[model samples]
Target: MIRHATTADFEFIFELYMHPAINPWLLYEPMDAVHFQPIFQELLERKVLYVFEVAEIPVGMCKLVPEEHRSAHVLYVGGIGIHPSFAGNGYGVQLMEAIKLFADAEGYRRLELSVAAINEKAMHVYEKAGFLKEGILRKYTYQKAEDRYLDEVMMSCLL
Candidate 1:
């Protein structure tokens, strides 16, 4: 099930965001839980964070940020990750399907997201989920730790 994330989800969200296998592709730089709290709180406040749960356990997370006015039909999907422990269980597909339904139900006609060009696995996953590669945004994201700017592949799915 995909549902709004709440304060109770702090640990799961934190663990997933900071996981060594996942962090580099995610939004935040690695940080201690103490430092992540405020950012987590802000996510809660924004009401865009969601959790993909199995029964009662959250195993994945994503952000569904809707655009306003003329672009209101678009939902920018971001910060998506499935726990490494559950990586091969088809959870990623399930999460993408649920997000599609969720966006459709919310009146979003377009779903947009960007992946690092270096992340072929994720690009494949998004492609399998029906998102088409729109173009490449050169040096779209900066990896401060690596002292390099990575290209981002833009993708979108029309629902």
Candidate 2:
């Protein structure tokens, strides 16, 4: 199940965001809980972060930010990650399917997201979920820690 995140989900959300297996592709740099608290709070306040669960146990996370006015029918998906422990269990596609349902229910006509171009694994999952690659933003994401820039591929699934 997917639902709005609560303060109680801090730990799971943190682990997923900071986990070595998941963090490189995410937006935030590695940081201690003390540093991430404010960001988490902001997401909560915006009501964009969501917790993905299995039998009430938080197992993944996602962010859905709706566009406004001219693009109101679009929902941008970000911060997507499945707990490393649950990786390879086919949950990624399940999570993607659920996201689609949620977007449809919310009346979004398009679901969009970007993935690091080199992240073939994630791209495969997104493709399985019906997202089609639109284009690549060359050297779009700079990883300060690694002093490297990664291309980001834009993708969208029409609901």
C-alpha local distance difference test of each model? 0.93, 0.96
As for candidate 2, its clashing pairs are none
The lDDT, on a scale of 0 to 1, for candidate 1 is 0.93
Q: Which predicted model would earn the best TM-score?
A: 2
Cand. 2 Cα-lDDT: 0.96
Error of 1 at 47 (Å): 0.2
Cα lDDT tens digits, model 2, 109-155, are: 99999999999999999999999999999999988889999999999
Clashing pairs for predicted structure model 1, backbone only: none
**How many clashes in candidate 2?**
0
Worst 10 residues of 2 by lDDT: 52-61
* Clashing pairs counted in every model: 0, 0
